[model samples]
Target chain A: MTAETAVPPTAAYAADAVLTEVVGLLVEVVGDEILIATEIDRDSSFNEDLAVESIEFVALAEKLEARYGARVDFMAFLSEMEMDEILTMTVGTLVDYIAAQPAGEPGGEV
Target chain B: MADVQANGLRFHVQHLRGGRASTDRPTVVLLHGLVLDNLSSLYYTLAPPIARAGFDVLLYDQRGHGMSDGAPTGYDVDTAVDDLAAVLKACGVTGPVHLLGNSYGGLIALHAAYLHPESVASLILVEGQCLDPAHSGLRPAAGGYPGGWVEDVANTLNLIAIGLECNPLGGDLGSRGARKAARMRAGADTLLNQTTLIEDISTVRLLTPGELAQVKCPTLALYGGASDLVDSGPMLAGQLPDCTLEIFPGAAHALLRDAPKELLASVLRWLETHSPAAPQFTGSAGGYRLPASGGEGAP
Candidate 1:
C-alpha cells in the first residue's frame, strides 16, 4: 500500500510511521476540527478525548484496508478496546504485530 | 465531585433508585461505555425506564472518566475498578447486584465480580468478553503484525471512528438544550488522545478458558449478530463456567441504541429465568425474538 510521496519520508516517521498514517486517516474522516495524535498514549480515550463517532470510525477502518492491501479483522479490534485505550497505540506496535503474521491471506478467522 | 466514593476516589454521581425495569425485575446498575460520563451515556435513554422499574440503580463516572476526577497519573483498569467499588458502596449496595455493563464496562464487571464475587449477583454483559491471558483470542503475531503497518494503523483508526459515531454519541454543544453535548465531545477527544491506553489495551485481547471457568454466576452474554464484536464473546462464552448466550441478530455492538426494545425485553427474560423473583415489565419478552428493524433478526 505504499504510494509515491511527493517528498520522501525521513527516518523520523520510521519510528512509528504506521501510527502517523492512522492519525492521518483520522484527520481525513473527522476533519482538522478533531485533534488527534499518531501515537495513542495511556491517557487517551475516544469518547473523552477524540470525539470520534462510531459510524465514522467504522467507515474509516473499512477504507483503511483498501490502502494497505489487506482486510483487517474489524470486529476483533472492537471487542477488545475502549476509546481511551485506543489512543495509546504506536505505528511500531502494529508493524511488530503484522511483521510476525504468517505469510499469505489477510484477516484470519480469529 | 458529587461526593460518591468508589474504590478510593470521589466521583460525580446520580441515582434513580430501582427505576423502571425496561426488561423487567431485578435491579441493574447500568455502566457507561469507555470515557463517557454518566450523564452523557445514561441521560439519553437508560435512566428513565430504569427509574420506573422499581429496582435500585446507580450511575456514576469513573476516576479519569467523564465528570469523575482525573488523577495526576492517568487512567487504568485498577482505578476504574476502585471507582466502581466505591460507587456501589455509596449506593448502600452490599449484597450481590445485577450488572449491565457495556463496552469497557463489561470488562470491569467481570474483573470486579471475580475480585469481589459477593458483590456481583448476575451479569448482563453487552458486547463485552473477558480478557483472560490464556484464551486471548487474537494471537499477537508472536512478534509482528499481519500487513502494511501504515495501512493497519489507518484501518484501526477508521474502524474506531465508525463504531463511535454509531454509538449514542450526543450532538453539538452549540445549542442551548445541548450544552452537555459539547462536554461529551470534549470527553471523547480526551479518550482518543491517550496513546498509552491504546498500547496497554492492545495487550488484552482474549481470555483464557481457565479464567472463564471461574465466572460461576448465571450470565446473559449479549452480542450483536451483525457486529464483529462477537469475536470477543465467542471465547468469553466458551470459557465462562456458566453462561446462557444469545445473539441479537441484525444489531451492531451498540445494541442498546440499535435495537433498544428487543435488547430490553431479552434482558428481562434472561433475568426472570435466572432469578425467579424478577419483577414484571411493561414490555413483553416475546417481542424481542426478531430484530426491531423488522426482518430476520434483532435490530
Candidate 2:
C-alpha cells in the first residue's frame, strides 16, 4: 500500500466526493468512451444503464478497495444482497454505502 | 486488478486476503468454466465467504477469456494447466493450494492435480467432465450429438462461432448499445472466429481412469442432479482414490449459479474436514463414498 495521502478522512466521507471517486473508478473500468455515450449520475444503474458486466463490477470493487480501503467492505455489502438486488443496484446505492462507512485513512489495512 | 504475465500471455488476476491474516489455511484458487464464464462467478458468490472463513482466495481470467489478453492458439488442456502453473508462480503462491473449478475449469483442475500433485492440496470439481470419450465409450447414440464431451463442446462452439461471425456483435458501439453484452459478444466472437479455441477443445486430451487414479489428493466432486454431465460424477468417485461425491437436487449444469448456497456450504465443510490444521479422524473409510442416504434430490 502506498503511504501517499489519499482523499482526507473528512472529504472521503462526503457523499458527493464519494460519488465522484466512484465515477472515476467506473471510467477506469468501463473506459471514457462510455462517459461520452452516457451521462453517469447517482441514478445511473450499473447493470442496465452503464452496461457494466459482472467482471467489470469486480474490477470496480477492487478500485473501491484501493480508494477507500478496508473500511468499506464492498464485497461484504454485495454478499448480503440477493442477485436481483445487486443487478438493480444504482451508483447512488454504492456512493451511499461508501459515504456511510466510518471515516478512516484510505488504503489502511483492516 | 493485477495483470499477470504467464505462459506468454497476460492474465487478469485478483487476490482476496483471508479474514485471519496470519491463518495457516491454504489459499483457494478458483477457475471458471469455458466461454461465457469468468472469475466473477466465483468471486461474487464464493470468494468473499471463503476469505471470511480464513482462506485466502485467488481468481483469474484464463487465456482468451474475460479481461485477459486473447491468444490465437494454445487453448488445449495441457496449455491450460501450464497457464495455471505459470499464473501461480507469477502470483508468488508457492504452497499447495486448493483448486475449485467449474465445468471445463474442473477438468483442468483434475489434470493439474494429476500432473502436479505437489502443488495442489485438494480439488473441488463442479460438473467436471473427466472421462475420455475413447476410454469411457461415451459414444453418442445413433443420431445423437456426434462423438463425446469434446465433440459436443466443439459442435456448440462451432455454432457460436458461425453466429458470431455472421452477426459481428459490438460493431456499432456508439449507438443503441448494451456495451457490456456487446463487449462480451465481441470477445467471444474473436476467440471463436479468429482463434483455434474450438479445435483445441475438440483435440483436448481428457483424463483416463488410470490418470485419475494417480491423483491421490482428497477430491470433492459436485454435480447437479439434472445436469447432463452428472454421469461423470459416479465415474470420478469410482476411479479417484479418495473422492466424495455430492449432487444438488433439481439443479442443472450450472451448480455455482443455481445452488450457490449449497455449493458454498459443501465447499466450507470439505475444506474444514480436509484442512491440515483439522483434527485427524482415525479409521475413516475414504475411497469413493457417497452420503449415507439421499444421494439424489431427496427431502
Candidate 3:
C-alpha cells in the first residue's frame, strides 16, 4: 500500500535530503532534548556514532518505512548485512539505498 | 515494519526473500520469545545470517508486542498456532516452511506442527521448553507460576520501571530509552499478570510421547549446557522420530544473545544437512507436490 504524503510519487528524493530526514528521525528517536546541537552526516554510523540500540533501530526502521513507503526495503537491506556491517552502517549507505531504488514504489515485493 | 492483517489483528511482519530460487525451497520463519521481546531478537541475531545463506526469512512480533496491535488477550498456545497459520496465509506462502523458535516460540512451533502437520517442513528449537512439563518435570505448583520465573518476571518489570527513571542510557538515548522502557513495563504488567497468558501456558495441553513420536518431520533441538532447561532438549530429541540435539557448553538460556556465532554455526550446519532448498518431496498423495530427482537430500 502506498503511504499517502504531500510529495508527489513522481518526485525523487535526493540522497542528501534523505540523509537529513534520516537524521531527523534519529533525533526524534534519540530524543529532541539530547540531540539538540548534534550534527549528523553521511558518514555517521547508527550504532557507533549515534549509539542506536537494537530497539531504537527498530523504531528507526518504522520511521523510514513511514517516510519512504514501499520505495525502500529497509528490512531487505538489513537482512543482507552482517552483524559488524549493521554496527558500522552509515547514513550514506541508507541514503544510497533509498536513492538507488526505482523512482516509484517498485520495491514493494521481496 | 510491514503491517499485515492476520487473525483479525494487525501484525508487524518482516519478510526477507533471499536469492534462493525455486518454490520447493522452504522459507525460514523465526519466532521470538515472550513479553519485552520482538522480531528484532532474531532479526539482529539469526535472520540476516540465514538470509545470506540463500534462504528466505520471515520474522514477526507476536500480538501485543512490538509495533503490532496489542489486544488485551489471546496469548494462549492455541491462538499462537492460529496466528502462525494466519501469518503464513497472509504472506501468501503456500509451500511448507521451516520454523526456528526461541524460548516460548519453540512451543508454538511444536504445537503448530502437532496440530497442522502439512504446513511445517521441520523445526529447530533454541533453548526450547517441552510442551509437556510433566515429561520434563518442569511443571509449577498448582495455581502458581514457576518458582523462580515469578521472581524473575517481577524483577524484570521492576527493573524496566526503575531504569526508565534513572536515565541509565544517559545522553541522548535516555529519553527514547525511558519511553521504550515505560511502554515495555506497561506491556509486561498486562501480559504477565492481567492476561490469561500465564494460566493458558500453565494449562497448555501436553502431547504424549506417543504423539510426539508420530510427528515425522526433521527436528533439531539446541540448549545451553548451563541453562536450567538443558534437560528438556534431550527429552524432546528422544521423543521425536528424527531429531538431533546440540548443547552449547558454558552457555545459558540466553544462548542466542550469549554465543550468537556458535548458534549461527550450529544453525547453518543444521540447515545444510536439512537443506530445505534441496527438494525433499518424493511421491506425494497431495496436490502441488513436486518430486525430488532422488532421495539425496530428502529427509
Candidate 4:
C-alpha cells in the first residue's frame, strides 16, 4: 500500500503544541509500521490511512491522559469513530480536544 | 479417544475416531467457567445437548480442575489452551472446532483462537470479557487460592463473583443463580488472573488485517440480559465481525442451571444456525464414538 500522503500543515494552529507530544505517544502505541516519516500532522487517520485499531486508541487515550495530566475520555472515542476515521484524525483535532478537557493524574482507567 | 504423549507433559489424550463420528456435524468444545463441580458440569449440561443437536461437544477440566492433574505450572490462559490443544491433537480432533468457553474458560478460548486461528472454527463467548490484568472485578492482583490458604479461598470467591456478574448465563440479577453465584463467591476455588494474558494484548493488535479478514466465520455472542458481568454485551458484539448478538431476556450467567429449558433451546438454535449438517455420533460404551475420522478442514 502506498503511504497515505500527509495533508500539508499550513501553519494555521500555532497553539497546538500538545499534538506534537500526542504524535509521539501515537508513534509509541502504534509502533512505526505504517508511518513513513516523522513529519506528523493532524490530518493523519490513525486507523484508516495508518491501520490502528480501536483497542490501541484506548491505549493512546490512556497514554495521553497520563503523560499530559489529562483524562481523555476513551469510551467516547469508541462510540464516535471507527478505526479508519481515527487513522486520519488530524493532530490539531486531538490536541484541541485534549486542551479542552480538565487535566488530572495521568493513568489508564481499566 | 486416542492419546498423544506430549513431550514433557505427562497427560496422554485419546482421540475418539470414525466415519461413525462423521455426522458432518461440527463439534462445540466446552470449557468450564469456574468453581468446578468437575467436568460433569460442562459435559452434563452442554455436551449431550450439543450432541443431540448433531454437533460434537468436547469437555475437559483445566489442570487441578476435575480429574485433570494439577501442576506447579498451574492455571493460566496459555496452559489451559495448551492442554486443550494437546487434547485435540491426541484425539486427532483436527479441523475447525467451535469453542464454547464459560467465564475464564471463554477468555482462554479467545487466546487460543487468537494464537492458533487454524484450530478455531468459531467462537461462542458466553459472557467472556477481553480481560486485562488491570481490569477484572478483583480489587487485588495477587489473590485467588494462593499465598496462604486464606487468600486462596478469598481469591476463588472473588474470581466467582466476577464471572457471576459478567456471565451471560447468570439469571435475574437477584435470582437464585445470583444467590448460587454469591454462595460460590463465598467458597472460592482457583485464582487465575491474566497478567501474561494482558502482556499478550499487544500481540492481538498485531493481528494483520488479513487474519482479521479471514475470520469471516459466524460468531455468536450471548448474554442473559439479567447478568451484571458487563454493563453492556452488545458493545463487545459490535467490535467483532460476522457476529450475531442476542440477549436471553431472563437468563443470567448460569443459563444452564438458571433457565435450563430456555438455555437448551437457545443453544440448540445457535448450534443449528452455525452447523452445516446433522450432528450424528454413534453411541459408544465409553461415550459418543465417531462415524468417521474427524476431518482436517471446515465442516
Candidate 5:
C-alpha cells in the first residue's frame, strides 16, 4: 500500500489521490484478497460491494487518521450520518470528504 | 488496527482522543457484550459523542471476540476483570477511569469496580446481568427464559452453536459472496463451538447484594424498559449506594443500537455532571490522535 504520488502535505489532494489512498487503506483493512475478486473504485459501496463490516470500518477510520491526520475527522463525518446513510456510504463519499479538507491545516471542522 | 498484548493474548483496541489535549476528566473505557458483539457496537454509538464532549474514549474487543485472539478457556467474570486490568495496564492508563459496559460487558464492569475499587472512577451499566435469578427474582417466568440470566444466556448460545454446527452459516455466506458476514459468523462459530464459553458463562458467580453495596463508585445503570434484563436496573439502583438508573421506554436489550440518540444524550449529561474537568465541547472541532509511535499502537 505504497503512495503512488508524493503530493506536498500542504496542498489539497486531488480526488483521485484520495481515492487511491482510500483503496490502499481498504486493502490493508479487508485484505488484498478482496482485490483478487473485485476492483475497488469510487462507486464501490462499503456495505454491498465490499462487505465492510462495522469493525472493519473502524479499522479504516484508524488508518485514515494515521495517513491524513486529524483534519480528516472520519468519526466526525460519521457522527453526522444516520445508520442507513452510513451503511450505504460509498468509497467516493469518503474520498470526496478527504479531498475537501483544507490541506495541511493545523485544525479544521469536518 | 491497534492490538494490545493483555492477559497473555492479543486484544483489539481503539482509543479516541477527546477535544482537549490535556484535561482532568477520566478516560472512558467501553466494553462490549459476548458473542456476536464487539467494540464496534459502542464505537459507532456512544463513543463518538463522548469523545466530542471532551473525554478520551477507549474501546476494546474482549478475548475471543472480534479481532482479538480467542482462547478455549477462561471466560469467567473474574478472568474478564483481570483482562480489563491487564488491558488498562498495557494501554498505559494508570489513573482511575470510567467503565461503561453493555449486557455481559456490564457484568464485567460491575465486578471490576467491586474488585478494583481504587482503579475505577465510575461505572455505567446498560442491561447488565450481575445478579443471579434465584436471588434477584430473574427466573424463567419473568424473562421468558429457561432459567436465570446466566442459564438463559448459556441456553441461547448453545442453541446458536447447534444451529451453526448444523448449517455452518459462515461457509454458506462465503459461498454466496458475503465475505464480511461469513467472517463474522465464522468467528462466532469458533468461540461458541470450540471454546468453553458456554460452560464458563453457566458457572458465572452472580454478584451478591453485599458485594454490590461495597462498590462505592458513582454508578449509572441504564436498561431498556421492555428488555428481559430490565429488572436488574431497579435492583442495581437499590443496591449500589451511589447509583442512578434510567430505563428507556419500548427499547429492548440492544439499547445502543435501538436508542443510540437517547443513550448518547444520557451519557453526555452523565459525564458532564460527573466529570472532574471543565467541560469543553468543540463539536466537529474534536479530533482523535493516533497513539504515538512505539505506544499502544504497536503490535
Candidate 6:
C-alpha cells in the first residue's frame, strides 16, 4: 500500500491534488503488475488503459470509500450511469467530481 | 476489503455496510462455490440489491479460492462448518445471520446450520448439491453411499486442471480471460485434485431426517425446473419443515448466470418475508428505489 492509500482526505480540494491521490490509490490497486504509475494521467481510462477487471474495480471502489469516507459516495456517483460508462470513466472525470464537491457536505445527499 | 484470519487461514473478506449500518440489522452472509468461483459471483449479482433493501452484506472467498489462503487438507463438511463459525466470529458477527450459499456452498450452509443452529437464522440454497446416496441415484445397491457428485465434481476439477495446464500457457483465451483463468486453474491443479477435497466431500456425512428437522430455521431452496438436480430440491424441501422450494421454469443448473433477474426477484421477496430484522428504508432524496421485486441493478 502506498502513503496515499492511508492518508485521509483533506478539507481543501484541488484538481491536481485529487489527481495525485487518485493515481496513488490506483497504484495500490494495480500493485506491482500491469500498472505503470507514470502512465496514469488525467485522461487514463480504467478499462482501456488499466484493463481493470470487475473484481479489481470493486477493490478500487472499496479503497476509495475507505480513504475518503462519506465524502465520495462512490456507489451513488456510478448509479447515474451504465456499467459501460463507469468502466470508460477517466481519471480526470473522477478528479473533477471530487473537486466539485462541497468541503463539509460529505454525506453526499445531492 | 478485509483480510480476516479464521480457521488458521487468511481469508479475503468483503463487508459492505448498508445505509443502516449503525442499526442492529441482521447481516446477510454469502458463500460462493468451489474451485474457479469466488465471492465475485454474488458480489456482482445479488449482494447490491439486498444491500439496497437495507441489510449489511458480507462476502468472502472460501479457503483456497480467490484471494484466500489455500490448505492441502480439510476440505470436508466438518472443516467447512468450523471455518464458517470461525469466520463469523472473526468478523465480529455474533448475531444470527442469513446464509446464502451457491452450488457446493449450499451443502456447507446446510451442514453449518445443522452443526451450529445458533449462528444461522435461515438458509437460501441455490442449486445445492445433495451428495448423499439417499438424495441422488448414485448410491450402491448394497445400501451404502458411494461415489456420485464427487465423481462429477472430480471430473470438473480434472477439466479445470487440464485447462490450467494447457489453455492459458498455450495462448488460447483472451489476454484478461487467460490471466484470471490461469489463476483459477492454479488452485484447481494444486489443491483441488492433488489434495483430498474429493474424498473428504464424498465421504462427508449428509443430514439425516432428524437433523434436518432440527434445523427449523425458515429456509428457501431454489433449483432450475429442467435441471438434473431438481429432485434434490424437493428432497431437501421434504426434510426441512419450514422450507419453500421454487423451481425456475426452463432454467438449468447455472441459475446464477441464467435467469438472474427472476432469481433476484425471488430472493428479494424471500428476504423481505423471512429476514428477522425489518428493513430500515431511508428516503433516497429522489434517487432510485428498487421496486419490491425486479432486477434494475443487474449487470
| Fraction of the true interface contacts (Cα pairs closer than 8 Å across chains) found in each model | 0.00, 0.55, 0.26, 0.00, 0.48, 0.06
Give the TM-score of each candidate.
0.54, 0.87, 0.72, 0.49, 0.87, 0.77
Q: Which should have the higher TM-score, number 1 or number 5?
A: 5
2 against 4, candidate with superior TM-score: 2
lDDT, candidate 4, A74-94, per-residue tens: 434432543334545766677
Docking quality class, candidate 6: incorrect
Measured by lDDT, the strongest candidate is 5
Q: Which one wins by lDDT: 4 or 5?
A: 5
DockQ of each: 0.01, 0.49, 0.22, 0.01, 0.43, 0.15
i-RMSD of model 1 (Å, 1 decimal) = 12.2
Residue B105, candidate 1: Cα error in Å is 0.7
Can you tell me which runs of candidate 1 are displaced by over 4 Å? A1-110, B1-3, B19-26, B36-39, B72-74, B131-185, B192-196, B204-206, B276-299
TM-score of 5: 0.87
Report the candidate with higher TM-score, 1 versus 2: 2
CA lDDT, every model vs. true structure: 0.55, 0.82, 0.73, 0.53, 0.82, 0.73
**Model 4 lDDT at residue B160:** 53
Which scores better on DockQ, 3 or 6? 3
Ranking 2 against 6 by TM-score, winner: 2
Interface RMSD of each: 12.2, 1.8, 4.2, 21.1, 1.8, 3.4
Query: lDDT tens digits, residues B169-279, model 1?
Result: 566554422443655555554455533444434443333456567778888888998765555555567668787788888899787767776776776666556544533
Ranking by lDDT: 5, 2, 6, 3, 1, 4
Question: How many pairs of residues collide in each model?
Answer: 103, 0, 0, 53, 0, 0
Candidate 5 lDDT, tens digit per residue, B1-299?
Answer: 39999989999999888866325677899999999999988888888878888888989999998778999998998999999989888988777788999999999999999988877888999899777757754343444444678888888999999988887754445431466667777888899999999999999998788888899999999999889878767766888999999999999999987888898899888888776654445556674443322123111
Runs of candidate 4 exceeding 4 Å displacement:
A1-110, B1-22, B131-216, B278-299
Decide which is better by DockQ, 2 or 6. Answer: 2
Give the CA lDDT, 0 to 100, for residue A66 in model 2. 80
